[model samples]
Structure formats: C-alpha cells, structure tokens
Target: MSVSQQVIKDKLQASIGDIYHIIITDTSNGCGQSFDVIVVSDTFEGKNKLQRCRLVNGALKEEVAQIHAFGCKCFTTAEWSKLVV
Candidate 1:
C-alpha cells in the first residue's frame, strides 16, 4: 500500500510534538516510493543532524520500511527562522 503525503505529515506532527513548518514532496512520481522532507521543530534543538534524523526515522519506522527512498532535513525553529529571513 502506498502512503499518502498527508499521512506522513500527520505522523510527523503527532510524533514530533509541536512543529513550526513541514514540507514534504513526493519524489517518486506519486508511487509513494520516495519523498523529500523538511521539518522544523524545537524538538531538534539540542540534536545534531544524525540525532534529528534518528528521531524522524524512529517516528516513521514502519513507513520507512515500506518506502524505497526517504530524505529529510530537520532544523530547530531558530535555525529555520534564519534560513527563511
């Protein structure tokens, strides 16, 4: 079964607590095999890139198993704010 973008978004929101921004792109041409994502949340505040990815991966453990490719960029709220400005 292919996972929808919204389902992934909801999962992230539920697992990560409060999120400032989330961008998810279906890079597998709607087959749900690949996705590129950007997530901004305070949950990443003290974590390095690997740790942040682990959190996201842990949250989406089942989904990640099904997906062929998944790429994610995680940032703290403060880091995201600087990039957007």
Candidate 2:
C-alpha cells in the first residue's frame, strides 16, 4: 500500500467504522492505468454507488489529482454480503 492508500484508508475508516475489506489494484498506463479501489463499509447506508464513490473521492482529493484515472467499487456491508449470496 502507498501513502495515499494509507491516508485514504484511515480517512475512510473514520467515517465508515470497521471495514470488511479493502482492495487496491495498481494498473498500467493511460486512463486504464489507475487505481481500482473496492471498499466495503457500513457507513454507505442509503448512499447510491455514485454518492459512495463521490465520498471516497472527497476523502482523497489530493491523491485523486496525482493520478490520471480513478475507479472505485463502493459497497455497504449489507450490499457486499448480498453479492455473495
């Protein structure tokens, strides 16, 4: 994990409570060469995917600027569990 990852994870942890899991994949160049983040948290509550992703973006504003592309899969714990069901 990079500094940005830790900073992001810490900020997210504060707002979301216990994180079920977090996965960050560092990809290649161009727009596709971006970080793909999957965050599972209870704090997502009534937020839609866009809202949850926006929140994460807000939390990592600086980091976002440093990268060319950004991608995220945000999920509430309940939503994530349902995916496995």
Candidate 3:
C-alpha cells in the first residue's frame, strides 16, 4: 500500500512540531513511489542542511524505504521568512 500526502504531512508534523508549513508532492505518476517535500519548522534552528535532512530522514525512515525517490527541502522559521520575503 502507498502512503497519502496527508499521512506524510501528519507524520512529519507529529515528529517535528511547530511547523510553519508542510508540503508533500507525489511525483511518481500516481504510483506513490516518489515524493517531493518541503518542511518549515522551528525545530530545524541551528541545524545545517545535512543535519536538517537527517532529521527528516530519521522521521520518515520506514516510509522512505518503500519510496524510490524522496526529495526534501527543510528550513527553520527564520530561514523560511527570509526566503519568502
């Protein structure tokens, strides 16, 4: 069975907390084999890109194993503010 975008969003939100936004896109021709994710949260503060990626990877460990492609962009609240404005 494949996971829905809402399920992915909920799981990340539960693990990371204090999220400004969570966007998950299914990019596998509707097969649910690939996903692109953007996560904005205060939990990523003080973490480097790799560290932030690791945090997301850890949160979605089991789900990722089933996916063939996973692309993630993570940002802190401050970083997101900078990017948006």
Candidate 4:
C-alpha cells in the first residue's frame, strides 16, 4: 500500500499533462517513505513557486498523506530550459 516513485510520477504526469521532464527519487534510500520529485511542464506557466507547489500537492494529496516526506521541485518548461542552457 506504500506509494512508489513510479506511482507518484505517473499520477503527476496524468494530472499535469505534457511533462517536459520528470525525475522522482526515493530519498529514503529504499524505505519508500520519502521522495524528491523534479517536474518540468507547461502546466506551471504563470504560476509562482508557492502556487506550483500547491498545484502539485493538490494532485498528490492522497499519496502524500501516506508518505513520511515528499519534496517537490516544479518548473515551467521555459524555466527548465533556461537552467539547462
């Protein structure tokens, strides 16, 4: 019944749509209790950091309640492109 990284990634991709990139890491080192997620998508356009986090939190509400820790970094496609270039 524990939430896995793939589950989180799938849910996010489904909720947000058209993800440019996504990386979910199990920071708990195999415990499956904590995670770090980095997502880049156009769904974040015009949203600030807090707003973006809220959107992600809302999408993962149920899964987050089951996990001990969830860290998310969301970026718009433009923002992500800037970082990589």
lDDT of 1 at 62: 86
lDDT of 3 at 81: 86
Steric clash pairs (candidate 3): none
The sequence of per-residue lDDT tens digits that candidate 4 reaches over residues 1-85 is 6799888988898898778999899999998999999999888898889999998898899999999999999998889989999
Order of candidate numbers by lDDT, starting with the best: 1, 4, 3, 2
lDDT of 3 by residue, 1-85 (tens): 4677877887798888788998899999888889999999988988899998898888888889988999999998888889998
Give the local distance difference test score of model 4: 0.90
Error of 4 at 78 (Å): 1.2
Which of candidates 1 and 2 is the stronger one according to lDDT? 1
User: Scored by Cα lDDT, where does model 1 land?
Assistant: 0.91
Evaluate all candidate structures by whole-model CA lDDT and list the values in order.
Answer: 0.91, 0.74, 0.88, 0.90
Which runs of model 2 end up more than 4 angstroms from their true locations? 1-7, 14-16, 29-33
Task: Give the number of colliding residue pairs in candidate 3.
Answer: 0
Please report the TM-score between candidate 1 and the true structure: 0.94
Error of 1 at 4 (Å): 1.2
Higher TM-score: candidate 1 or 4?
Answer: 1
* Candidate 2 lDDT score relative to the true structure: 0.74
**Candidate scoring better on lDDT of 2 and 3:** 3
Q: Cα lDDT for residue 51, model 2?
A: 90
TM-score of 3: 0.91
For all predicted structures, in order, the TM-scores are 0.94, 0.75, 0.91, 0.93
